[model samples]
Target chain A: DAGITQSPRHKVTETGTPVTLRCHQTENHRYMYWYRQDPGHGLRLIHYSYGVKDTDKGEVSDGYSVSRSKTEDFLLTLESATSSQTSVYFCAISEPGQGPPEQYFGPGTRLTVT
Target chain B: SQKIEQNSEALNIQEGKTATLTCNYTNYSPAYLQWYRQDPGRGPVFLLLIRENEKEKRKERLKVTFDTTLKQSLFHITASQPADSATYLCALDLSRDDKIIFGKGTRLHILP
Candidate 1:
């Protein structure tokens, strides 16, 4: 319970369509991350933000993009949704110099691409 | 390339016994290792974090041990209960970057 919330907890879209998921947090954490979890692949980081207007790609950033215009929000976008991109996306937040430096996750958003 | 691996098979254990899960990595040294527990249809919850300098850490019935020399970490749950059954994930923070890498996770089942 990181005081985080993700919009559209469940979604369905068609291939080639664009989609965006929103993650909001009330913790005022400095670090926010987006990860997708799929069977056999585990959870792969798509992107992360260190601060407002500061972001970086992760291991699997090929078809995805992220933005953080405010400290309390991080958005993940699929420029062109594909069936292969279907996964349960999770949002996590961590505060620098915090107790254990471990990330706290939100509920998650399940996306299905047809 | 850096890689992290964990037992993919579900681990079955008897209630009241200790269940141990292993996480191994290669080609990377992490500043710390973290463990998370995930239930079905939910996001992972943070469990424990062990630094390179610390050999072990404990919280109640859960214990985590990190061995940088071996590039491995072990997570243990003592006096296991059916409620403790879930997928356990091990993660490592990149030494040179702010990113973190996670293992595939191991499913644990505590049977009565």
Candidate 2:
């Protein structure tokens, strides 16, 4: 309900294929994050962008890349999709410098690699 | 590595009763803790945040208690209703940064 949207709610792709997931926000937040959720592992951060063209790797950054060219759009790309990469991906945003600012998440995208 | 934990068992209680959930941490001391409610097929919604300096926080029917000494936090919902059934997750802000770590979460159900 925070004016955040994710594209391709569900997708199925073959192994070794490249896939890109998009996240757009109308709130103009400075912080954008990409996370993957799996059974028993909960959610783990993949990458985050603090400002336009300023991106950083997270706890789990292998095989994943992200870009923030504009203020509203943050893109996550899987260089080579694999069956292990199949999981629910979520995009989140937060306003920096706020008092322990809380992140607002998008509905999420489910990806399956065969 | 810092870790956060919550009881995995689903908490069951009668409607109009108070429901309590616990979150514990290890190897890392946090300055603040957060609670979030997640429903099936949806992202989590922020519920409450408590600072280490503060002992407790209350918002309407929801209350949270933070004890740094014990490295645990308690979430309570008074006058619980059937609509409150969902999985509740707790998060902690890591030292010196705003990065957050989350728990697996505990599912809650309110019986009518």
Candidate 3:
């Protein structure tokens, strides 16, 4: 219930195609992150943004890229999708100085690359 | 590299019994640890957070214990019910770097 939403809740695409997922937030949090969840590998961070135009790679950023042009929107793009990239993607927002830095997550987008 | 390990095996407990899950980490010092609950097809929801300096924290029937020296955290759900069955994840914050790491999560099944 964190004013966060991910577009295209579910999608199925072929391999080697470009795919992009969008995360929009109304909370105006300073930190936003993209993570992928798979069967054996819990949640692995893909990328994160501290502020508009500021982004950094996470542990599993090999096949993904992210960009943030405004505070409320963060985009995760897979230049050339692969079956290995099929997983549930989640977007989270956090307010650093507000409280415990606890993250609020969006509903999630399920992407399947076949 | 830092690693967090949670029991990959599922835990089954009878309804009304207490259920406890464990999270262990190595090679990193985190400032605080957190627990989250996730149902099938849903995003993780925050449960409890315990700081390194705090030995334990309680909310409702959930209790979380943090042992910085041991690099471990324990989550306990008292008087569990079937509705309590879900996957529980443990996360740690790398305070200095403003990043977090999560464990694979332990699934709990409170059978009635």
Give DockQ: model 3. Answer: 0.82
Quantify all predictions' global Cα lDDT against the true fold: 0.93, 0.90, 0.92
Candidate 2 residue B35 C-alpha distance from true site, Å: 0.7
- RMSD of each predicted structure: 1.0, 1.1, 1.0
Predicted complex 2: DockQ: 0.68
Give i-RMS (Å) per prediction: 0.9, 1.1, 0.7
lDDT of candidate 1 at residue B24, scale 0 to 100: 95
List model 2 lDDT by residue over A1-114, tens digit each. Answer: 498999889999999999999999999999998989888878788999999999998888999999999999999999999999999998989885866678888999999999
Q: How much RMSD separates candidate 1 from the native structure?
A: 1.0
- Report the CA-based lDDT of candidate 2 relative to the real structure: 0.90
What is the C-alpha lDDT profile of model 3 across B24-108, one tens digit per residue? 9999889899899999998899888898889999999999999988888999999999999999999998644667989999999
Q: What is the DockQ of each candidate?
A: 0.84, 0.68, 0.82
Reference-based TM-score of each model: 0.97, 0.97, 0.97
Clashing residue pairs for model 3? none
Clashing pairs in 1: none
User: Model 3: how far is A17 from its true place, Å?
Assistant: 1.1
Chain B TM-score of model 1, please? 0.96
Per-residue error for B72 in candidate 2, Å, reads 0.4
For model 3, the superposed segments whose C-alpha errors exceed 4 Å read none
